[model samples]
Target: MKPPVLLTRDKFRESVFARDNHLCVLCGAPADDAHHIIERRLFQAPQEKGGYFVDNGASVCEPCHLRCEQTVVSCEEVRDACGIKRIVLPEHLYADQPYTKWGDPILANGQRIRGELFFDESVQKVLKQGKVLDLYTDLIRFPRTYHLPWSPGMNDDDKMMQSLAAFEGEEVVITTKWDGRNTTIYPDGRLHARSPDGRPHHSQAMVKSEAARFSFDIPPGWRVCGEDLYAKHSIAYDNLPSFFLGFQIWNERNECLSWDDTLEWFELLEINPVDVIWRGTFDEKTIRALPLPNPEGWEGYVLRLARSFSYGDYPRAVGKYVRADHNKLGVVHNWRTAKVTPNQLAEKS
Candidate 1:
């Protein structure tokens, strides 16, 4: 089938804004720009039309537009907000089928899809060729945690609100959200900072070296996800239980272990789990009224379902509340080459 005739750039922007009633789909502010869910470069013939389909565009304010560029607002989210059912692509682009690259669907914005989207074809090919490591390593990386309903700066939406309403009666576990690097450790002893590059953060070596002190037989694709609090980011901790504090565990099947199982494994593996701030049925007021850190060390809290859930359910299963000014300070200070300030541990009695 032939693709629709391409509209000029200005027409595309005008049509999208008009369709959205000149309102930002993210925040309800006056629209200032048109956003493309999928990059133009990913299209078969980007230069010709720049993939400017109205369905692929969203009207957003400048703040939301910047968030989209930074990928804080995911493409799938924009599509859901704008009521775009499916990305319309030219017929030529269809030959690629489900995914443009292994582990990447053509519909996804880069690799930051809100849910589990596709399997890695490259990993499957390698596994078929007897490369077991490829399957294990690629399967166990940390998944991104979404913001809670009350988290500052989030765009209000029905899905998240629905998730919040459903969460009201369920037992939930809340833990202190430490300010540090998100690191993952494999049973094979490989450590990685939260990055696509599969390399540890420069400030993470001290934490990784400390983790090397313990050993365990974690099943092939199970991963220990944690925070590396060795180097100061925005918050400086004078007394920390450990450099690497285990938070979540993901198995080969991409299931997040129950809180009980995670705690049990942390104890069995001699790992320090993050402090449990509260554990009970969900309460919106209590969570909201919780006092902020007095001296500015504490970042915030994370709430998760007490039971196990699949990786794809992360958006509904877990949510985080970071301090209002945390992102601002985090951006001003570059942790990559920032001075490493060792957090002092409490003296053993």
Candidate 2:
């Protein structure tokens, strides 16, 4: 199946391309190619009651895919660095066989990333290595972001850094951002997750075991990627299903919905999802003027599109404004509170 698209050669790539609006999953890269999901994957259509495998069957390109295989720090080190309390997977995602190779991950920039695609004892052992974790805080400094280890070890700061707009200060309304690695749990009762780089994130064995507990039929036509909040992202530790956050929701066509519609869907699921700030109409300056009311973090905002603006490829589409007072790096942590700024004070008055 040699198609013009980057990952179109593989059927799985076809699935993902059909799913991701042809955009790269990592760094929100526009879809360029197919990334092998080296671990748990199935050649057959997914069924709700049956089990699947770990993400051992998919494929990736280079560099970015490698991040999932291991972090800048080792797994154990990352685990320890983030101070995670537990890891949970019911075990239906994988068959008795192991997955190895994980292959190279596809990047936003057309670069190839590598990961643990092959499921071997060596891979298992490699993944088992120590990760230095810091469970108490999420506000890590730049370069400091990778110091801990695994993606799960990331705290509120890490959470804010990736999902929200830039942080401006204490007035930011920081809510308990949900914790779940970016994933798209399919509505067909299938669970397809991904790493940050647009590579496949399968843990099918866990999906089968964990899925049964939920009352809602995992939506058959939708895939929502958000942090699966467990002990890692919580002040207290727990891996309960109810705790997962449903962030970006995509249709089967890989078309994204408006932020408002997303919120409504979560409501349908009976789950409360956190989001970037929602304010009445304001210009870029006004949005910049408002206090960054987050519990604490900012990757930049996943700005919700108003219904007027919501349409094809709208949820993933965003336009945001930020404060000029940010530090030298333009990093959120470096950004200062606008309360001291003139616009904010004037607005309050």
Candidate 3:
């Protein structure tokens, strides 16, 4: 067997970082090294055609890279241990590659600009002592608008209120915004948290039971996005009916269904849907005057156009309005803390 060819070029490292958005594909932390799924040595042989290709590479942090080198766990195990959904390489990197598992392209947003790179010289030095080296850059992901707590003096809030006024008469659906970790259930039964890294989120038995009962109802390539209220966040839902409350039913293309369709599917699956606060034209004054949905004071409300619409591969018709005092209770300490038994949390009840 010929020795595997190693990919030591800086450009190759940069490409790997860019593909992973500069975070550890397994843990969602800053990536310090690039790991080869197939050992680089295996490709060194003169007859081997598979050299250092982005198709088999993953941007990983130092700890994850060390775990990979230890050979004590499988790649999937390492990924789960680190809370990763899956190693997603940006589409552009694998455009001509034969691989099928490509990640959503990182689009430019206000939070992070696409194509920007953040290099850490110290991390690079640490990686040099390890088997996998040559990592130097970190790529950032595009940002999406998230629900924010209302602030009195913030000029942005004033601007947002003015902008929302335009939709005052447009029909919209207002769903009670729960204060909990955002989660998603894919058509394939995979559950993940809503984060830049798509970390795996564990649910309680009841939550899993409901998901299993409705798994068959989920169309292929569609996803159920919701809030995991298994644990209390800053807002405690002592009167909550269930641990999970689904809000959106999205299609394979990532476009959300209309309010009616979302409710229909939830009813069919017998899943608890987020409380509908209101259904009418966008009424900023009415929304502002509405009381919190729960005792903790509802986090806010989500406004979704009765009809579905997309903006450059994103859902643009949806927006959220939060109470200024929403975060007054302080931050939720336990966001994505998974159980010791990886699969036990979701065991069939």
Candidate 4:
């Protein structure tokens, strides 16, 4: 809510020390200050707690700090062993892809989901063709700027403001706004199902219902996928209309969808998606030691494994979502649809 004073290098070190238990995130060297590898920036904690505190800041050791400098050093190079991975900035995530029709859309012939998915001709074609891969590559090659979509729920409305307040000065990485019905591009490309809430269940049906009404021009090799929200809520949460919300193209390394690729998919699909609450490499201790403004509705932050090194698909990525629900980030709501309590109205009058 309040702006932070830029921390001096010494101040920055102090803050890092305060937050990091005086140990580097990488090596156990007593931290001199916070070392931000992304820009080689450093910040010290204020004598109090009201100074420049970039959300992206992370505590680093001498070795890890040296690797970030543009100047190449041999021994320091090892610190580069596992640099903090950067997320795609919102602008960078959605620059636009070269339009090219790759092939026919893969439909679900027959699918089975025991533990893994089994695809029929409908699904096989998707797997063999790797249409999802092409679409992914194209979107990643260039994505468009993203805008988040809001709903009636308190999840985004309440938690976003908390992250914003606590990490305002920190480096905030914004990714593309994904648009499309919630669709999952199954690695097999055969088995798919839509979630009841419009999230992609699996790469499955294109339910033609009230919530989902679209033309038939599906991008080749891909399915216009997502959940049957209308169906789920309308019928019995098991059948009926579909209220699709998100989309994902089949990736060769479906199990290992990288952060970069995930960004592009969200862009190309044009669906509303969750965002990076806070980031910039740090271990549990350093993160825990750091002091942040406690706020209501705070979900704290999320830590996702680097995209390149990811080992699972969406809904199952090596991502850890954490946050504190307090008075930190205020709830961001669509004031228009927000309710007016009778007590409040009476007070106003």
Candidate 5:
């Protein structure tokens, strides 16, 4: 057999990007990087192992690049996107692999970013050590509640209030904002707590395992965003319907679902959603005077437009009003270090 040609990393990336038309197949955004479907570090020889070939790469945007690394955007999906068949690895490539170069920096959007490097002793030990990638950087967050008072002289408050005012008299959906970690569950069942790194925290261990139990067949680019209520944070709940309560769902186009649609899908998945506190036309007076559920344990409520909106329109579409002193006085102990406490669940017939 003749020896195949080898390509440098730069040449490999360029060839992969060129093959995909310089566009992210996952989201159709401007492609700035090419990613390996299999771990590049697993390749003992680029020429012999075929690691540097375009068939093993996918052109992606920076955000989608992170998704590829996280496995939320599956290797199969990347292969389908690139119009290639799955790259079957030889057993020798991964079997009995040595921990050679884990936690190495990843190239994305033409820059090196923090890799998926974590301790082996923790719950994150399941993660492989070699060829790490950074956490997703563009994950959406719950918009700040405009009805609640922003600190005085806060630069963005005026603009936020203006956006909120535009929705006056529009129908809105108000849901219980549980005092827990804001978590995102991908179609592949990966859970990420809202944080700078978006890693599944130790406190969220139980919920992460539970979420992974469900086979979510959502569309390739869709995501389920919700609150993981496994551990008590600001308020210790006496009863929790489920450890996870979905609030919003984002489609492949990055557009959020309407409240009615969100509820229906949550039902379809057998996943409980946050309690709907109220649903009616926006009336500041009615909203302010409404009594909160469980005045002692409830965190507060979130107000959002009943209709769907694009990802970028979040600032104008959602808001929340937390109880007084919730941030400072509500949380008395660190949920991570404290002993694992189980919240009571309502009995099902």
Candidate 6:
């Protein structure tokens, strides 16, 4: 007899990878194999149903796939190794099974849908152990406020004055705006960039080393957000005091501490805060006349309110002012070329 067609293979694999952003759910690397979390052979039918379902699959790298297959590690261990809470399964699988791993229950054909589907104690145990640090959940995007030009026909000085209007009566602290890649430090000492595209950042080791240097504690579900200033972006920060500078501290709820509190935490951890430009509220004329923070004309300044604000809500508490004629050098054909080499200065010559 002719072999039964393997119709579900490619489609199921693609769907899993797509859901996982083509990265191994275990290590966040490029996935090459679709792992069956529940071995296909364990299902009742050999050729027909449960084996090909998407709920039982995970997109994994070669090494991780091997580890899953050899039984060297449990499925929960594999998920925790990468901080993945639960692998999302295809919605359709719940139709027949009524329940699947990582999903809520569905009512069978004639039964009334009475109570809500819930994870049993065993399932809850697995889920609690597999807490994943999701990108937005663990690492928050540092908010940026724009510089408002004075008016349609106003001069540069007038524009600067206009931008400072919002902070006229508020206590404001200004700091130099460093050009760098955004990074975050998790409570478990893991470091990651703010990228959603699955592209890896080169500063993981650097961040870890710097984090180790600090003696302070970060409570669970909190993270330290900073600027990874090792490389040159639009403007080269050649005189930067350090490779990384702590700018904000966020709790599990994604609320950012106010400027003063953030600085206090930075001091406690011995982490360098961004260079301060000015403190205290400034009059429009004073703001207009203030000198640029850097003689070389760095990007701009960040104005922050001195007190802490509620988490996850936008605050009119912070703003930035970028130099109109800031350096736009170092444009490259590809971003990989922007990495600062050890001998970048020598090579430039």
Compared with the true structure, what per-residue lDDT tens digits does model 5 show for residues 1-349? 3332456788888888888889998899999888877665445322334456666678889888776665555565778888886353322232222121222222233222222222223213323321333342333333334444432222322222344564687899988878878877777776676432334467777777767765366657677888877776766776678888889988766688999999888887778888888999988777878888766666778788999976535655787766766766446465566776666666775
Winner on TM-score between 2 and 3 is 3
Ranking by lDDT: 1, 5, 6, 3, 2, 4
The candidate with the higher TM-score, 2 or 6, is 6
Candidate 1, residues 1-349, lDDT tens digits: the string is 4545467789989999989999999999999998876554344333334767787789999888767654456566888899887665432232333332122332322332122423335334433443222222253335556677677734332122234754768888988888888887777677777643454556667876866765356778678888888877777777788888889988776788999999998988888998888888888898778765442766788899899987645656788886667766654265556667677776676
Q: Once superposed on the true structure, which residue ranges of model 4 sit more than 4 Å away at CA? A: 1-111, 114-253, 289-301, 309-317, 322-349
lDDT per residue as tens, model 4, 207-291: 3432133322224433333332331211122221123444223343223344556557656545434444445553444544543
- True-vs-predicted CA distance for residue 217, candidate 4, Å: 8.1
Model 6, 1-349: lDDT tens digits are 3432333877778776776788988778899987766544333223434456554567889887766654344555655554444443332222223332322222233221111111234433443444421101233334324353421222233312223444668776778776666777766676666522235656445666777676237778677878776666666644555678887887655567888788888887777888777787655566556787574535666666666654312224555666655534554436664564421222233
| TM-score between model 6 and native | 0.51
Q: Residue-wise lDDT of candidate 3 within 1-349, one digit each (tens)?
A: 3332335456557777887889987778999987765444324222333345554567889887776653333445544443444443322132222121112222223121112111124323433444323221122222233332342322332323223433546798778877776776765455656533444444444456657767778988677878777766667555566677888787654456877898899888777888887888767677667765663546777777786643222213566776667656765445456232211123344
Better of 3 and 5 by TM-score: 5
Which TM-score value belongs to model 1? 0.61
The candidate that achieves the highest TM-score relative to the unseen native structure? 1
lDDT of 2 by residue, 1-349 (tens): 2212222235545554555556544445454544434333222112211112212112223443455454332222323322323321112222322222232233344333222222245554544542312111111100111111112233333311222222222122212333234444544444444533333322233433443344245454445555443322212223233435566565533345655677787776665466656544434445544455542333334343343221211212333332222222222231123121111111222
Worst 10 residues of 6 by lDDT: 110-119
Query: For each candidate, what is the lDDT?
Result: 0.67, 0.35, 0.54, 0.32, 0.63, 0.55
RMSD of 3: 16.5
Instruction: Say which prediction, candidate 2 or candidate 5, comes out ahead on TM-score.
Output: 5
TM-score of each candidate? 0.61, 0.34, 0.51, 0.28, 0.56, 0.51
